[model samples]
Target: MKMQRRSLRIEETLVKAFIYFSVICVVFALFNILWHILSHGVGLITWEFISSYPRDMGRAGGILPSIVGTACLVALAVAVAAPIGILTATYLAEYAGKSGVMRAVRFSIDTLAGVPSIVFGLFGFAFLVIFCGFRWSILSGGLTLAFMILPVIVRTSEEAIKSVPYEYRECSLALGATKWQTVARVVLPAAAPGIVTGIILGIGRSVGETAAIMLTAGSSLGLPTSIMDPVRSLSLHLYILVSEGVSFEMGYATASVLIILIFCVNLITNLLVRYMITKRMGAGAH
Candidate 1:
């Protein structure tokens, strides 16, 4: 009996050690990549580099147009995906309970989540650019990205909504609140952080996307005047600089800017989530 106990203890220690080792490896890899990009790219960042346009095939000047285009694509994609995703999530979690239709819906979302981004690009190119006649523009790229990120939002939002305790819904209903009122006031408020997280994830994917944007939104360095106009995103610009052998210096600089942009977005959204949580807590206390 003592020997078996000792064996179990050794196994547990080994498991714990393995987990710690895995975490350290992941963290080290992340930091190493960040160091590499920041070391090379940080020096190239400047007001002129940020505010000016590419002069010689992205070898000289700034990435202002690419930055603007990336923002536009991410914003448009999130705006389109968030509402639809949230609503679908709400339906799946709150209303559709253990039905065949619900199962099918869940299956579809899962499948979509696993689909490659390049495949989405091809679909968008064929459907939106050709069939819908939107052509190669921000509109097509944004819509394509919306489709790509929709499943992520739906799955995350659904899980978040489900995580809200049923007791909260019951209490709201007991207090003479309707189903919609309970969901709107109690459930959604509780799930806001998770929903925001999903949206932020979608934004991150959209921002870093290159292939989809390349296929749907033509690589135009000029600043886009409208959604109908083709635009170049930072990821695509970086790809061009590297793939076409424009300039590694400019490529690294663009990569650094992209990283900074994503970091800022995540930071801002996290702050917003904290504010919402704080406000909710204060209101409850009052």
Candidate 2:
């Protein structure tokens, strides 16, 4: 009995030590990244810098045009990609055959998810922007970003649609509904929230992307007056600021704002999801 008790105590102690060490390591990594971002970016984030454009390139510079261009890039990318992605997902989940072609499409999507962003950048530069004569225009960057987000959107949307109860589809079919009608009325609506979540995830990646946008988007750092014109983005600007030996002041500030943007996007998504859940609950209550 004494030997058994001693072994049990040792096992408990070992488990506790492992948990404590693992937690400390994780916390240290997170806090270190946050601290570095704050330490570099805190000093230069003034109102003037936020509003102004990068003047020859320095610490006191503003990121107005970059911000505006980044917004447009994200908007254009999402708009172009979301519809097709959702539709493709709808088809795959509801209509597509389980044939070799369909299997191939699924495999391609998986491959796309794994492809390096830098390779996408190279491909975008070589094909979309340069070979196609788009010349680093918004259209090229947006389309490239759209492709970058496609796999994400398709997978997420498919999962969302799949999550809809089979009973709903069966009832619609039982009522003499056509396939399209059943999917349109019964499946899509139920999966809307999941689709939205997928869209948000795609948007998050597109907005934060540096490598894929670098070659395609270019680094003009001016407000985007038109899609035909070259544009800059916040991530691209941050990269430039870091590599060009510019001060950390603007760099840190940009990092901070990027964090804030991500935080706000996540928060908004959370609230929207909560609202959706509450609405469903209310309907159930009724």
In order of appearance, the predictions have TM-scores of 0.88, 0.90
Model 1 segments beyond 4 Å from truth? 1-21, 268-286
lDDT, candidate 2, 170-280, per-residue tens: 999999999999999989998898889889988889889989888998777667788977788888888888788686667788988887787777887787678767766
Candidate 1, 1-286: lDDT as tens digits: 9999999999999999999999999999999998999899999999999999899878899999998998898889999999999999999999998999999999999999888888888999999999999999999999999999999899888877987768889999999999999999999988888788888888888899888888999999999999999999999999999999999999999999889878887897788767766765775685
**Which 10-residue window of candidate 1 scores lowest in summed lDDT?**
277-286
| Candidate no. 2 TM-score | 0.90
User: Total clashing residue pairs per candidate?
Assistant: 0, 2
Q: Please report the TM-score between candidate 1 and the true structure.
A: 0.88
List per-candidate RMSD values in Å: 2.9, 2.3
What lDDT does each candidate get?
0.91, 0.86
Best by lDDT: 1
- Quote the RMSD, in angstroms, for model 1: 2.9
